[model samples]
Each structure stands twice: as structure tokens, then as C-alpha cells.
Target chain A: MSQDHSLNLKNSHEDPAKATMEGKNKFLGLWFFLGGETVLFASFFATYLSLRESTAGGPTSQELFGLELVFIMTVLLLTSSLTSVYAIYHMKNNNFKKMQLWFGITALLGIAFLACEIYEFAHYIIEYEFTFRSSAFGSAFYTLVGFHGGHVVFGLSWLISLMVRNAKRGLSLYNAPKYNTFAIYWHFIDVVWVFIFTVVYLMGMVS
Target chain B: MTDNTNINKINSYENTRRKEEMKHQVITFVLMIAFTLIAFLVVAAELSRTFVIPFILLLAVVQVGFQFYYFMHMKDKGHEIISSLIFGGIWIAAVTVLTFTTIIWW
Candidate 1:
């Protein structure tokens, strides 16, 4: 066998995303970062739950949240998660084109989610006079969900930059782990949204 | 001739492994979608708030598991660090939620 074949043999035992030491380090570091993010979100959730009922004669969740809209947003974000999985799957298979295509779809879905969120906020502000300053409930609601929307914005920009910078280089030792870590981050966002959908939207609607 | 045969075997093995991985990803994706739909339906049906809240939260918990285990590849070998980090975070989050719900409110 040639030298290239020997190198391939070395990587055969590990995942493509972790074929190198650097990749392993990045993957591990990103997970730790997400762990910190979990506590941050937990603090927000606790505050929101404590303040959720303190509308002070202002509009409450039952009066503000529309199940249909929130449901659509949930579906969009969940589908984006699936698309990102597909992207990483393609990355594993060494198909850069397919990976890019799937990531593009994921970003598009994220954009749609953001648009729906903005519209939902605008509708609340205009129809129900539910600004962030309206009441304690308003303040908590905006902080919790607004923080999530900000994450989506940051993730979308990150994905776009990664795709553009790597558009021509294709997947390699340097970029495979980057894509892999991004996929993990994207999944973490989806996981957080799952809780938001259940705790904030579904629970709020029923309560 | 023996070297060629050995190369072929390695290639086939890699292909088989990839197929297995793809199957797992697809299954996880389908299950996550199903969980989302059930959560929506539970809320839309206007069931008892008590029942719906816990039920939807359980479904969400399952979906999160699928995301972390399958999509994030934490179920694979060599992910112990990630698992520890995530579970530790969960422990802290649970404590925070409990403290708020019990102590602050009560």
C-alpha cells in the first residue's frame, strides 16, 4: 500500500469528524460550552415561570400565545434539526455537495422560524398591547423567548459563514470537525426549543 | 492478489458500518417528528391542563434524548466527556427549576 493508504488506515478506526486530535478537542469543547448554555437557559426558564402569572391586569399567556403559530414554529425548528442531521450524515460520507445542500435547507428553515417569531411578537404588540414594558409577565415572556430567537439569529449567521468559507475547499481535517461541531450546536438549539415548545407554549395554552 | 482481497474486505466493512449509522439517524429523525406532532395534538385537543403539561414535557424529554444520543453521536464510543458535561448540566438545571418552583413560590 502507498502512504495515502496508510493514512486512511489510521483514520479507519475513528469517526471522520474525530479523525484527528484537533477534531476531538473541538467536539469536546463545544459540548462543554453547550452545557454552560443549558444552565443559562434554566435560569431564564425559572424566572419566566415565576413571573408568568404576574400580568398585573395585563394580557397573559392564555390571551397572548396562539397555539397554531407556536405549533408552526415548533415544526419548523424540529424539521431544521432533521435537516442538519442529514448534513452531518453527508459529511460523514464525504459528500460535500450533499452536506452543503442539507445545511442550506436547515438555514432556510431557521429563517422561516425567525420570521414567524418576529410576526408573533409584532402581532402581540399591536393587537394586545403586549410590549415588554406592559407588565412583569410581559417582561418575563419577552426575555425567555427573545433570548431563544437571538440564538437562532446567531446560529444562522454562523452556518452561513461556515458554508461560504468552505464552499470551495470541501471537507477536510480542518473543516469536518467545524461542520460536526456546528451540527451539535444546531441540535442543542433544537433541544432547547423542544423544552420551550412544551413548557412555555403547550403548558401555557392549557393552563 | 491477497492484498487486493484484503482491501475489498475493508471497503465492504466500512460500507456496512455507514449503512447502520444512516439507519439509526433516520429512525431518530422520524421519532422526533412524531413526538412533535403528539405534543401539538395534546395541546390542540384541549385536554386537562394537568395531564397535558406533564405529558408534553415527557415527550419533549424523549425528543431531547434522541437529539443528544443519536444526532449528537453521544451514544457512540469516545463521547464520555460529552455525556458527563450534559448530565451535569441537567442536574444543575433541575436543581434550579426545583428551587424556583418550591422555595421562591412557596
Candidate 2:
């Protein structure tokens, strides 16, 4: 094989995402970033936990959170996570078109999840008068969940950019790592949501 | 001819292994959805607060475990450093949560 084994179809490895040094670095770097991201979210969760009951004079978590909506949002995001896995799966098989198609599905689910979130927030502010400034509970609730929403927004932008920028290029070692990195980050966002729905919504309903 | 045959064999073998891995991922996704349903059902059923809280949190933890280890392939080879970093983050997360829950309550 030539020096650029990654460019040689016959010499290419099964996973272009980790076939080169840059790809490996991108993989490791994303995980390292996620480790830090975990701590960042944990702090927000701690704050929310400490102040979740301080409603002062406004609506509380139980009254504000609807199980039906949260369940739908959870399914959307969780399915998006699976779709991303499908994208990565295709990437490994060198099936660029299928990878893009699955990633497109992942983005659609994310957008749907964000739409539900925006609707939830509007319902709170309109129906319950539960603005972020209303109480400690309100502030914590908005900050925690809003932060997650903000991540989804950012992730959507990231995914869209990656898709658009690489649309003409197809799959190559140069860009495979980038897509893989975004998939991992997307999965981590879902991991955060798992904790949020459990601790914030379900626990709030319990008590 | 020999080189072409060799590459073809490796590609087929890798494709089979990857297909097997994908089966596991789909299975994990199904299990995660089931866990989410159970958590929601238990909470919606209005069970004892103390029991339900811990139980749902346990389910969340298990689901996340499946996400990381199965879907993210953290259990795959060459992930030792990544594992250490993730577990370290978890340690910090635990301490942070504990501190806020215990020390800052009003």
C-alpha cells in the first residue's frame, strides 16, 4: 500500500473514524471534553436539587411538569440517540449515504424534542405564570432544563454544519472523526437528559 | 490477486463483526426504552415517595450505563483512558451532588 493508506480503498480500515492519528485524537479529545461536561451539568443539577422546593410564591415542579410531554420528549431524544448510533454504524461500514440519512433522522428528532421543550416553557409561563424570575424553584427549573435545551440547540447546529460542510466530500478519514465526535456528544446529551427526567421530573412528582 | 483476496476477507470479517455489534446496539436501545417506560409508570402510579425515588433513579443509572457502555462502546478495547476520565467525572458529579444536597439546604 502507499503511504496514504486511508486514501486507498483496498488499504482502508473498517472504521475510517479511527484510521488516522487525527481521528484517534479527535475521538479521545471529545471524550475528555465530555468528562468535563459531566461535571458542569452535575453542578447545575446540584443547584437545582438544592433549590427545587423553594417555590416562594409560584407553581412548583409537580404542577409545572406534565408526564405526558416529558415522556414524549424522552422518547424523541432517546430515539435520536439510537439513530445516531445507526449513523455511526453506517460510517464504520463505509456507507456514506446511509450514514447521512440516519444522521438526518437524528437531527429531525432533536428538533422535535426542542419544539416540545419550547412549548413546555411557554405553557409554564402562560398557564402557571412560572417564569424564571418567579421563585428559586422556577429559576432552578429553567436553568437546569433550559441548559439542556441549549445543548440540543447547539448540537443541532453542530450536526447541521457537519452535514452541510461534508455533503459533497462524502466519507473520508479527514472528516469521519468529526462526525463520530458529534455522535458521542449527542449521546452524552441524552445521558444528561436521563438524569434530568428522573431526578427533576419523576422525583418531583413522587413527593 | 492474493492481496485483493486478503483485503476482501478482512473486510467481510469486519463487516460481520460490526453487524453483530449493531445487533447489540439495537437490543440495548430496546432495553433502554423499556427501562424508561418502567420508570415513568412507577412514578405515575403514585407509589411510596421514598421507594419510588430511589427505584427510578436506579433505573436511570442503569439506562445511562447501557448508553455509555453499549451504545458509546466504552466497553470496547482501547477505551481504558476514556473510562478513567468518565468515571472520574462521575466521582466529581457524586461529590457535587452530595455537597449541594446536604450542605446547602435551607
Candidate 3:
């Protein structure tokens, strides 16, 4: 079924991702899902902002967040975002191998980012006694940042699955949209992170 | 056949345009990185809170705009409805954040 249009569109269209009816629908539908996700994250952010000061004698964001670690995490995620852009670039250029290679780089960077997050959370729990039940601030912080981490884990899984499933198929209209959709999702992750660093970490240090 | 030659011509032309688009995206990425550095530095420099907070927030907004327009391809054709959907979400997000922050001011 996938190859039905393979002959007609393998190298013909500028963006194979949107060349077909299904691909167009998938692209639009993914954006719609992301729009809803924006609201979902907004709610978490609001909760975090309102309750951030209710530390209940526990450690505060000022005490807990280190600029160095967050800075490193930001670079890793931002570089990964660019790498996914490269992957999509190659995808559009109809170079399957290069596309996979860039996505592989993207995945590696994502893993590194995840590793840094795990280290951060563990340091908090073991060193500072900042558990979710510590106070309102703890709960809000964990929910907002932890939810973002959960998204990273989910995105990694999604990328790996798509790569492995299509390892042998190369570029086809059927799967191009899937890869493009992943890129969109990955960029949204970076967008959320920009806000997190600004509102949570940087502002936490400011005041 | 003549059609074969025509297809090659169009593909090459499109490839050129895509390459130019890639160039712009790379430029966007560089500017975004610069913005991130400025944000961190301003906070690290221990500036006055009155100015620092809003300045950094504005930088964040600009960087996010680059990401949305360049990386997400919202600047490309056929994204009108997608643009509306995103702006709508942002509208709700702003309202919700305002309500929560004001409600719990203590």
C-alpha cells in the first residue's frame, strides 16, 4: 500500500510529506493536537507560578536550581532541535540515508538531555529532600518539570520507533509525513523549554 | 521523452529554493542561540529586577517566534488555519496565567 505512490512521488514532489491526502491530514491533525497541548501546559505553568512560593520551609527554586546544569540542558535540547531540522531537510531533499543519520544524531542528543534531567531529579530527592509531598511548591515544581521530562521520554520512544520501523523502507510518501510530524512534535518540546528556562530557572534567579 | 527532461528541470529548481530556505533557517538558529545567551547573561549579571524580568521575557518571546516561524514552517504557505489555532491556544494560555497569578497574590 505504501509503495502504491512510491513510483510517482519518490523524487518528484518538493515536500513528499504533504504530497498526498493522508499526509496533508496527518500534518494538520498533528498541529491541532499541539494546539491543545499548549493549553494543557499553560495550566501546569499557572499552577507552578501561583504555588511556587509556598515552599513550607523546604528548599526553594532559588536554592534548588543551578544555572550551570540548566544551561547545559538548554544547549543540548536546542542543538537537538536543530538536528531534527536537518533530518527534515534531508527528508525533503529525498535523501533517506542522510535523513536517518541526522535523526540518529537528534536521538543521541535527546538521550543526553534525558540523562541530565534524571541526574537533576535524583540530586534533588537524595540531597535536598525535595519530594513531591514536601509542600505546595514541591508538588507544583515536580508536576510541571516532571511532565516535561515525561514528554521527553515519550518523544524519544516515538523517534526510535519510527526510525526502526522504517529502516528498510527508505523514503516514501506514506512515511514522510510521519517523520515530519515527529519533527513538529520535537520543535514544540523546545518551545516549551524556552518558557521553562525563562519563567522558572532564569526568573527564579532574578528575584 | 520531453517529460523526463521537464521533471528534472522542476526538481532542480525546487531543490534550489529549498536550499535557500535552509540557509534562512540556519540564520534563525544562530540568532536564537544569541538570544539565549543574552537572556542568561542578563540574569547572571545581577541587573535590577524591574528591567531584567521583562527584558528576558521579551527575549524568550522573540526566540520562540523564530522557532515557530522558521523551524515549525509556520511561515510557509498553507498554514493560515494552523497559525490561527496556535494563536488561539496562546490567547487562552495568557488569560489562564493571568487569572492564576493574580488570584494567589499573597
Candidate 4:
């Protein structure tokens, strides 16, 4: 009976995030999911790169890309990644309040990124008349970057949902893993953005 | 009394481990910022495309490594599954890019 009591207390006191069998399985499964996501993005990248030069007499990358605005967008998203890191740090410490705070900052930053992207797309359409249907390059550009922007939107919604659903309950073994996996997803999104910034924006500006 | 002591010991160990992890994360974040600055500077300065392109890509590669190993916590124990899977994904990506670029050019 004493052994059973000790075992129960030990389980209760352990890290809630990885304490349960279900949580561990979810964690591992998500990593594999991300692996598949990597391949999906890779194929997109390949397609984009292949068709990048096929402008079909429309605005080319060099004609449309402005470095300053993209630079700001990059900074915002990168800082959001850092804020998410802080959130996870707090999560590890089991500091529910601080974790939520940092995650909130992360969500705000992501929103700012989306806002910048919207403005960027608007500027492209209004100033340059570069629509997705304008040329092959246009299609490739929108599909690649727009896909990433779609992910940012999804990530933001996921984050907000996690925050709202768990606000009253505080951190527990169940929701802790949920938060952790969401963080992993956020980091992957940022990682994809990193590539987009480099291959699409930076390289486009230079070439 | 023994149980209390054991619990305290475990707590202290976890605390130290967490501190070390935080330090690594902060350092990685700083390095990533520096990499970003270098990438921007290379382009803003209008260096030769040949040099600027490769240099910025190299920086990006390093930053990706840091993002995966540090921010994603792939360096921690029991993360071998994640690490292997990600690397496998990368392998496939590399092959796809190579195949497309080569075949299209030919």
C-alpha cells in the first residue's frame, strides 16, 4: 500500500508535459508529421525554383521584390520564434502565467507578419499589376510564399485556440503536451519562413 | 524523510538542467540574429551575386541547424527519432532538388 501511494505521488509530481503515454506518442508522431511536411515544402521549393525565370513578359522577381519591407517581415517572424522559445522555456519551468504571456507575444508577432504580407501582396497587385495569373513566375511566387502565409495563419489560430481553451484550467499533463506540440509546429513554420526569406526574397532582390 | 530528500535531489537536478538548456537557447537566438544581420548586410551592400548568394545561403544553413538542434530541442536525449526523421526528410528534399534542377537543365 505504501509502495502504491509512493508510486502515485511520483507520477503526480513528474513533468506533466511528458508524463503520460499518450503525450509521448503524440510528441513522436508530430515529429514524423513534420518530416512529411518538410517533403511537401521541398517539392514546392523545387517547383518554384524551376519556374522562377519563366516570367512570360510579366514583372520578374527583381522588378517586384522590395528588400526593406521583407526585411521587416523577417525580423517580426524571427522575433516571434524567439518569443515562442521563451514560452517553451516557461512551459518547461511549469510557469503557466509566463508561458501564456510569451505565447501571446508570439501570436501578436505572427499577426504582424500576416499584416505585412497582406500589405506586400496588395502593393504588388496595385503597383506592379502582378497577379497570380499574370505569369508562371507569378504563380510560383504566390503559391510558395502564399502557402507559407497560409501556415502562419493556421499557426496563429492554433495558438489562440490553445491559449483560450487552457486559460482557466492552467497547465496539466494533458494540455502541457498540447502546448509543447503547438510550439514545435510554430518553430517548424518559422523554419520554413527562414528558407522563404533566403531563397525567395533575398535571392530575388539580388538576382 | 528519505522520500523528501530524494525529491529535493531530483528537483535540484532538473533545475540545473533547465538552466543549461536556457543558456544554450539564448546563445542560439543571438547567433541567429547575427546570421540574419550578416545576410541582410551582404545584400544591402550590393556585393557580387556570386559571393552574396553563397554566403547568405551558408549563413542560412547554419541558422537552420541552430533552429533545429537548439530551439526545437532536438539535441535532448530521447529525440533520436525526431532527429533521424528530419534528416531523412532533408535527404529526400536534397535529392528532389538535385533531380529537378539537373533534369530540367539537360
Q: A18-110 in candidate 3: lDDT tens per residue? A: 988889999999999999989999999999999999999999988998889999999999999999999999998899999999999999999
The residue-by-residue lDDT of candidate 2 on A1-207, one tens digit each, is: 257565543466557878788889999999999999999999999999999889997888877778999999999999999999999999888889999999999999999999999999999999988998999988888999999999999999999999999999998878889999999999999999999999999998886
Model 2 chain A: lowest-lDDT 10 consecutive positions: A1-10
Report lDDT (Cα) of residue B82, candidate 1. Answer: 80
**The best candidate in terms of DockQ:** 2
Q: What is the DockQ of each candidate?
A: 0.70, 0.86, 0.78, 0.70
- The DockQ-based CAPRI class assigned to model 1 is medium
Question: Would you list the clashing residue pairs of candidate 1?
Answer: none
Which candidate comes out best when scored by TM-score? 2
For model 4, how many clashes? 0
User: Which lDDT tens digits does candidate 1 get at residues A57-97?
Assistant: 99988888888888789889988988998888777767889
Q: Alpha carbon lDDT of residue A137, candidate 2?
A: 88
DockQ (0 to 1) for model 1: 0.70
Model 2 scores a C-alpha lDDT of 0.92
Residue B35 of model 4, lDDT score:
89
Report the lDDT tens digits of candidate 2 across residue range B1-106.
9988898889998989999999999999999999999999998899888789889999999999999999888999999999999999999999999999998764
- Of 3 and 4, the candidate ranking higher by DockQ: 3
Where in model 1 is the C-alpha error above 4 Å? A1-13, B1-8
- Model 2 has a DockQ score of 0.86
> TM-score for all predictions?
0.93, 0.98, 0.97, 0.94
Q: Docking quality tier of candidate 2?
A: high
Steric clashes per prediction: 0, 0, 0, 0
